[model samples]
Target: MSTTWITRAETAADIPTVHTINAAAFETGAEADLVDALRTDPSWIPGLSIVATDRHDRPIGHALLTRCHIGTVPALCLAPVAVLPEYQKTGAGSAAIHTALRSAADLGEHFVVVLGHPAYYPRFGFTRASTHGIGLTIEVPDEALMALTLDPEHPLPAGIVHYAAPFGI
Candidate 1:
Protein backbone atom coordinates (compact mmCIF):
# COMPACT_ATOMS: atom_id res chain seq x y z
CA MET A 1 0.00 0.00 0.00
CA SER A 2 1.27 3.46 -0.85
CA THR A 3 1.18 5.73 2.16
CA THR A 4 0.81 8.62 -0.25
CA TRP A 5 -2.54 7.33 -1.38
CA ILE A 6 -4.99 8.16 1.41
CA THR A 7 -8.36 6.56 1.93
CA ARG A 8 -10.77 8.68 3.95
CA ALA A 9 -14.43 9.10 4.68
CA GLU A 10 -15.88 11.53 2.16
CA THR A 11 -16.62 14.99 3.37
CA ALA A 12 -19.06 17.32 1.62
CA ALA A 13 -16.07 18.96 0.00
CA ASP A 14 -15.20 15.78 -1.89
CA ILE A 15 -18.60 15.16 -3.47
CA PRO A 16 -18.12 17.12 -6.65
CA THR A 17 -14.79 15.62 -7.60
CA VAL A 18 -15.94 12.19 -6.60
CA HIS A 19 -18.90 12.57 -8.90
CA THR A 20 -16.58 13.82 -11.57
CA ILE A 21 -14.42 10.78 -11.16
CA ASN A 22 -17.42 8.53 -11.57
CA ALA A 23 -18.65 10.36 -14.63
CA ALA A 24 -15.24 10.15 -16.22
CA ALA A 25 -14.73 6.51 -15.38
CA PHE A 26 -17.99 5.26 -16.80
CA GLU A 27 -19.23 5.46 -20.36
CA THR A 28 -22.61 6.76 -19.25
CA GLY A 29 -23.75 9.31 -16.68
CA ALA A 30 -25.98 6.86 -14.78
CA GLU A 31 -23.58 6.18 -11.94
CA ALA A 32 -22.74 9.82 -11.39
CA ASP A 33 -26.42 10.69 -11.49
CA LEU A 34 -27.30 7.93 -9.08
CA VAL A 35 -24.86 9.25 -6.52
CA ASP A 36 -26.52 12.64 -6.75
CA ALA A 37 -29.94 11.17 -6.07
CA LEU A 38 -28.68 9.09 -3.16
CA ARG A 39 -27.40 12.16 -1.37
CA THR A 40 -30.92 13.57 -1.13
CA ASP A 41 -32.56 10.53 0.42
CA PRO A 42 -33.05 9.15 3.94
CA SER A 43 -31.04 6.14 2.82
CA TRP A 44 -27.76 7.97 2.48
CA ILE A 45 -25.56 6.33 5.08
CA PRO A 46 -22.85 8.77 5.98
CA GLY A 47 -19.29 7.41 5.94
CA LEU A 48 -20.46 4.61 3.65
CA SER A 49 -19.43 6.70 0.69
CA ILE A 50 -15.65 6.90 0.80
CA VAL A 51 -12.94 8.40 -1.37
CA ALA A 52 -9.40 7.55 -2.27
CA THR A 53 -7.51 10.81 -2.35
CA ASP A 54 -4.28 11.71 -4.01
CA ARG A 55 -1.39 13.09 -1.99
CA HIS A 56 -2.84 16.56 -2.29
CA ASP A 57 -6.24 15.33 -1.03
CA ARG A 58 -8.12 15.45 -4.31
CA PRO A 59 -10.47 12.51 -4.82
CA ILE A 60 -9.41 10.13 -7.56
CA GLY A 61 -11.66 7.22 -6.72
CA HIS A 62 -14.93 6.46 -4.94
CA ALA A 63 -16.96 3.57 -3.52
CA LEU A 64 -20.47 3.91 -2.11
CA LEU A 65 -22.39 1.53 0.13
CA THR A 66 -26.06 2.37 0.47
CA ARG A 67 -28.99 0.84 2.30
CA CYS A 68 -30.95 -1.95 0.64
CA HIS A 69 -32.99 -4.94 1.74
CA ILE A 70 -32.90 -8.68 1.35
CA GLY A 71 -36.48 -9.57 2.23
CA THR A 72 -37.10 -7.54 5.39
CA VAL A 73 -33.45 -7.72 6.47
CA PRO A 74 -31.39 -4.58 6.11
CA ALA A 75 -28.32 -4.83 3.95
CA LEU A 76 -25.95 -2.68 1.94
CA CYS A 77 -25.71 -2.29 -1.82
CA LEU A 78 -22.40 -1.45 -3.46
CA ALA A 79 -22.71 0.27 -6.79
CA PRO A 80 -21.17 2.75 -9.19
CA VAL A 81 -17.67 1.99 -7.93
CA ALA A 82 -15.28 4.08 -9.98
CA VAL A 83 -11.75 5.38 -10.24
CA LEU A 84 -10.37 8.06 -12.51
CA PRO A 85 -9.43 6.73 -15.93
CA GLU A 86 -5.77 7.17 -15.13
CA TYR A 87 -6.11 5.43 -11.78
CA GLN A 88 -7.85 2.25 -12.94
CA LYS A 89 -5.72 -0.89 -12.45
CA THR A 90 -3.44 1.07 -10.12
CA GLY A 91 -5.20 -0.02 -6.88
CA ALA A 92 -6.89 3.32 -6.22
CA GLY A 93 -10.32 1.78 -6.78
CA SER A 94 -9.42 -1.26 -4.71
CA ALA A 95 -8.31 0.90 -1.81
CA ALA A 96 -11.55 2.85 -1.84
CA ILE A 97 -13.58 -0.37 -1.97
CA HIS A 98 -11.61 -1.90 0.90
CA THR A 99 -11.99 1.20 3.02
CA ALA A 100 -15.73 1.37 2.42
CA LEU A 101 -16.27 -2.33 3.22
CA ARG A 102 -14.23 -2.01 6.42
CA SER A 103 -16.28 0.97 7.49
CA ALA A 104 -19.51 -0.91 6.74
CA ALA A 105 -18.32 -3.88 8.78
CA ASP A 106 -17.41 -1.59 11.64
CA LEU A 107 -20.90 -0.10 11.48
CA GLY A 108 -22.32 -3.63 11.96
CA GLU A 109 -23.70 -3.87 8.46
CA HIS A 110 -24.31 -7.60 7.99
CA PHE A 111 -24.47 -8.06 4.23
CA VAL A 112 -23.68 -6.32 0.95
CA VAL A 113 -24.50 -7.01 -2.69
CA VAL A 114 -22.89 -5.87 -5.87
CA LEU A 115 -23.59 -6.40 -9.58
CA GLY A 116 -20.15 -6.15 -11.04
CA HIS A 117 -17.30 -7.90 -12.73
CA PRO A 118 -17.41 -11.46 -11.40
CA ALA A 119 -13.67 -11.84 -11.25
CA TYR A 120 -12.97 -8.49 -9.62
CA TYR A 121 -15.58 -8.71 -6.85
CA PRO A 122 -14.51 -12.16 -5.63
CA ARG A 123 -11.16 -10.67 -4.74
CA PHE A 124 -13.09 -8.67 -2.15
CA GLY A 125 -14.71 -11.80 -0.69
CA PHE A 126 -17.95 -11.63 -2.68
CA THR A 127 -19.54 -14.90 -3.68
CA ARG A 128 -22.38 -15.97 -5.95
CA ALA A 129 -25.47 -14.55 -4.29
CA SER A 130 -27.68 -17.12 -6.03
CA THR A 131 -26.03 -19.89 -4.01
CA HIS A 132 -27.49 -18.21 -0.97
CA GLY A 133 -30.88 -17.97 -2.70
CA ILE A 134 -30.61 -14.19 -3.05
CA GLY A 135 -31.48 -12.45 -6.28
CA LEU A 136 -32.85 -9.31 -7.80
CA THR A 137 -36.28 -8.54 -9.16
CA ILE A 138 -34.75 -7.30 -12.37
CA GLU A 139 -33.09 -9.57 -14.87
CA VAL A 140 -29.32 -9.77 -14.75
CA PRO A 141 -26.50 -12.11 -15.54
CA ASP A 142 -26.40 -14.84 -12.91
CA GLU A 143 -22.71 -14.50 -12.24
CA ALA A 144 -22.84 -10.73 -11.90
CA LEU A 145 -25.00 -10.62 -8.81
CA MET A 146 -22.77 -11.22 -5.83
CA ALA A 147 -22.92 -10.84 -2.07
CA LEU A 148 -20.62 -10.71 0.92
CA THR A 149 -21.48 -11.32 4.53
CA LEU A 150 -19.83 -8.49 6.39
CA ASP A 151 -20.69 -10.03 9.71
CA PRO A 152 -20.06 -13.73 9.47
CA GLU A 153 -22.20 -14.28 12.57
CA HIS A 154 -25.22 -13.16 10.51
CA PRO A 155 -25.55 -15.20 7.38
CA LEU A 156 -26.66 -13.43 4.21
CA PRO A 157 -30.39 -13.08 3.89
CA ALA A 158 -32.24 -14.76 1.04
CA GLY A 159 -34.79 -13.01 -1.15
CA ILE A 160 -35.19 -10.64 -4.03
CA VAL A 161 -33.25 -7.44 -3.32
CA HIS A 162 -35.22 -4.26 -2.97
CA TYR A 163 -32.94 -1.32 -3.48
CA ALA A 164 -33.45 1.98 -1.73
CA ALA A 165 -36.23 4.19 -3.02
CA PRO A 166 -33.83 6.49 -4.74
CA PHE A 167 -32.46 3.61 -6.80
CA GLY A 168 -35.81 2.96 -8.53
CA ILE A 169 -35.31 -0.80 -8.25
Candidate 2:
Protein backbone atom coordinates (compact mmCIF):
# COMPACT_ATOMS: atom_id res chain seq x y z
CA MET A 1 0.00 0.00 0.00
CA SER A 2 1.64 3.21 -1.15
CA THR A 3 1.14 6.16 1.18
CA THR A 4 1.33 8.63 -1.67
CA TRP A 5 -1.44 8.84 -4.26
CA ILE A 6 -2.12 11.26 -7.09
CA THR A 7 -5.40 13.15 -7.33
CA ARG A 8 -7.02 14.83 -10.29
CA ALA A 9 -10.32 15.90 -11.75
CA GLU A 10 -12.06 12.91 -13.36
CA THR A 11 -12.06 12.66 -17.13
CA ALA A 12 -14.27 10.80 -19.57
CA ALA A 13 -11.66 8.08 -19.82
CA ASP A 14 -11.86 7.54 -16.07
CA ILE A 15 -15.62 7.06 -15.87
CA PRO A 16 -15.71 3.28 -16.01
CA THR A 17 -12.96 2.92 -13.40
CA VAL A 18 -14.66 5.43 -11.15
CA HIS A 19 -17.91 3.50 -11.38
CA THR A 20 -16.09 0.32 -10.49
CA ILE A 21 -14.55 1.93 -7.45
CA ASN A 22 -17.93 3.05 -6.13
CA ALA A 23 -19.60 -0.26 -6.79
CA ALA A 24 -16.81 -2.14 -5.05
CA ALA A 25 -16.74 0.11 -2.03
CA PHE A 26 -20.42 -0.08 -1.17
CA GLU A 27 -22.67 -3.02 -0.39
CA THR A 28 -25.02 -2.21 -3.26
CA GLY A 29 -24.81 -0.70 -6.73
CA ALA A 30 -27.02 2.24 -5.71
CA GLU A 31 -24.10 4.58 -5.20
CA ALA A 32 -22.60 3.59 -8.52
CA ASP A 33 -25.94 4.07 -10.23
CA LEU A 34 -26.33 7.47 -8.61
CA VAL A 35 -23.02 8.53 -10.08
CA ASP A 36 -24.20 7.58 -13.53
CA ALA A 37 -27.46 9.46 -13.09
CA LEU A 38 -25.74 12.56 -11.76
CA ARG A 39 -23.49 12.73 -14.80
CA THR A 40 -26.45 13.54 -17.03
CA ASP A 41 -28.32 15.63 -14.49
CA PRO A 42 -28.35 19.41 -14.58
CA SER A 43 -26.68 19.47 -11.17
CA TRP A 44 -23.48 17.95 -12.51
CA ILE A 45 -20.46 20.18 -12.20
CA PRO A 46 -17.69 19.18 -14.58
CA GLY A 47 -14.56 19.72 -12.52
CA LEU A 48 -16.01 18.70 -9.18
CA SER A 49 -15.82 14.97 -9.77
CA ILE A 50 -12.38 13.80 -8.68
CA VAL A 51 -10.38 10.61 -8.35
CA ALA A 52 -7.30 9.38 -6.53
CA THR A 53 -4.97 7.01 -8.30
CA ASP A 54 -2.17 4.65 -7.42
CA ARG A 55 1.33 4.89 -8.89
CA HIS A 56 0.19 3.04 -11.98
CA ASP A 57 -2.51 5.74 -12.46
CA ARG A 58 -5.45 3.45 -11.89
CA PRO A 59 -8.29 5.18 -10.08
CA ILE A 60 -8.65 3.65 -6.65
CA GLY A 61 -10.90 6.17 -5.00
CA HIS A 62 -13.52 8.66 -6.06
CA ALA A 63 -15.27 11.78 -4.69
CA LEU A 64 -17.88 14.00 -6.19
CA LEU A 65 -19.42 17.43 -5.57
CA THR A 66 -22.60 18.40 -7.31
CA ARG A 67 -24.98 21.35 -7.30
CA CYS A 68 -27.44 21.43 -4.41
CA HIS A 69 -28.93 24.32 -2.55
CA ILE A 70 -29.28 25.37 1.06
CA GLY A 71 -32.56 27.17 0.90
CA THR A 72 -32.31 29.49 -2.06
CA VAL A 73 -28.52 29.83 -1.86
CA PRO A 74 -26.24 27.80 -4.07
CA ALA A 75 -24.22 25.02 -2.45
CA LEU A 76 -22.43 21.80 -3.30
CA CYS A 77 -23.29 18.32 -2.06
CA LEU A 78 -20.65 15.71 -1.34
CA ALA A 79 -21.90 12.18 -1.58
CA PRO A 80 -20.97 8.55 -2.13
CA VAL A 81 -17.25 8.96 -1.54
CA ALA A 82 -15.71 5.57 -2.24
CA VAL A 83 -12.41 3.78 -2.02
CA LEU A 84 -11.76 0.44 -3.68
CA PRO A 85 -11.88 -2.45 -1.21
CA GLU A 86 -8.16 -3.04 -1.49
CA TYR A 87 -7.49 0.65 -0.98
CA GLN A 88 -9.60 1.19 2.14
CA LYS A 89 -7.82 2.94 5.05
CA THR A 90 -4.94 3.87 2.75
CA GLY A 91 -5.95 7.55 2.58
CA ALA A 92 -6.97 7.26 -1.05
CA GLY A 93 -10.49 8.38 -0.23
CA SER A 94 -9.25 11.24 1.88
CA ALA A 95 -6.91 12.38 -0.87
CA ALA A 96 -9.74 12.28 -3.39
CA ILE A 97 -12.05 14.25 -1.07
CA HIS A 98 -9.45 16.85 -0.18
CA THR A 99 -8.55 17.35 -3.80
CA ALA A 100 -12.20 17.65 -4.81
CA LEU A 101 -12.94 20.19 -2.05
CA ARG A 102 -9.92 22.24 -3.00
CA SER A 103 -11.00 22.22 -6.61
CA ALA A 104 -14.47 23.32 -5.54
CA ALA A 105 -12.99 26.19 -3.55
CA ASP A 106 -10.79 27.20 -6.45
CA LEU A 107 -13.87 27.40 -8.64
CA GLY A 108 -15.32 29.96 -6.17
CA GLU A 109 -17.76 27.51 -4.60
CA HIS A 110 -18.78 28.70 -1.15
CA PHE A 111 -20.51 26.08 0.95
CA VAL A 112 -20.65 22.30 0.82
CA VAL A 113 -22.86 19.80 2.64
CA VAL A 114 -22.24 16.12 3.18
CA LEU A 115 -24.22 13.43 4.94
CA GLY A 116 -21.44 11.21 6.22
CA HIS A 117 -19.62 9.84 9.19
CA PRO A 118 -19.37 12.41 11.97
CA ALA A 119 -15.98 11.26 13.17
CA TYR A 120 -14.42 11.12 9.72
CA TYR A 121 -15.73 14.31 8.19
CA PRO A 122 -14.67 16.68 10.96
CA ARG A 123 -10.99 16.07 10.24
CA PHE A 124 -11.67 17.97 7.03
CA GLY A 125 -13.17 20.92 8.96
CA PHE A 126 -16.76 19.82 8.62
CA THR A 127 -19.17 20.64 11.43
CA ARG A 128 -22.71 19.63 12.26
CA ALA A 129 -24.93 21.18 9.63
CA SER A 130 -27.64 21.99 12.13
CA THR A 131 -25.24 24.09 14.13
CA HIS A 132 -24.99 26.37 11.15
CA GLY A 133 -28.76 26.25 10.59
CA ILE A 134 -28.54 23.83 7.70
CA GLY A 135 -30.94 20.91 7.50
CA LEU A 136 -32.20 18.47 4.91
CA THR A 137 -35.67 17.97 3.51
CA ILE A 138 -35.11 14.30 4.13
CA GLU A 139 -34.48 13.11 7.66
CA VAL A 140 -30.98 11.95 8.54
CA PRO A 141 -28.89 11.72 11.64
CA ASP A 142 -28.14 15.23 12.78
CA GLU A 143 -24.51 14.49 13.45
CA ALA A 144 -24.14 12.75 10.13
CA LEU A 145 -25.18 15.78 8.16
CA MET A 146 -22.13 18.03 8.00
CA ALA A 147 -21.46 21.36 6.39
CA LEU A 148 -18.32 23.29 5.52
CA THR A 149 -17.70 26.78 4.32
CA LEU A 150 -15.04 26.56 1.65
CA ASP A 151 -14.44 30.31 1.92
CA PRO A 152 -14.09 31.93 5.30
CA GLU A 153 -15.76 35.07 4.06
CA HIS A 154 -18.91 33.18 3.26
CA PRO A 155 -20.56 31.50 6.18
CA LEU A 156 -22.64 28.34 5.89
CA PRO A 157 -26.12 29.41 5.01
CA ALA A 158 -29.09 28.25 7.04
CA GLY A 159 -31.91 26.20 5.52
CA ILE A 160 -33.08 22.82 4.33
CA VAL A 161 -30.89 21.16 1.73
CA HIS A 162 -32.31 20.68 -1.71
CA TYR A 163 -30.46 17.85 -3.37
CA ALA A 164 -30.52 17.13 -7.09
CA ALA A 165 -33.47 15.31 -8.55
CA PRO A 166 -31.72 12.01 -9.06
CA PHE A 167 -31.12 11.89 -5.34
CA GLY A 168 -34.91 11.50 -5.05
CA ILE A 169 -35.08 14.04 -2.24
Among residues 3 or more apart in sequence or in different chains, the pairs in candidate 2 whose N, CA or C atoms overlap within 3 Å are none
Name the candidate that leads on lDDT.
Answer: 2
For residues 32-106, write the lDDT of model 2, one tens digit per residue.
999999999999999999999999989999999999999999999999799999889999999999999999999
Backbone atom clashes (below 3 Å) for every candidate? 0, 0
lDDT of 2: 0.94
Top TM-score hit: 2
Q: Write the per-residue lDDT of candidate 1 for residues 1-169, one digit (tens) a residue.
A: 2444689998988888988998999999888999999998877899999999888888898999999889888999998799889888888888899999999999988899999999899999999999999999899999999999987789988999989887888
lDDT of each structure? 0.90, 0.94
Off by over 4 Å in 2: none
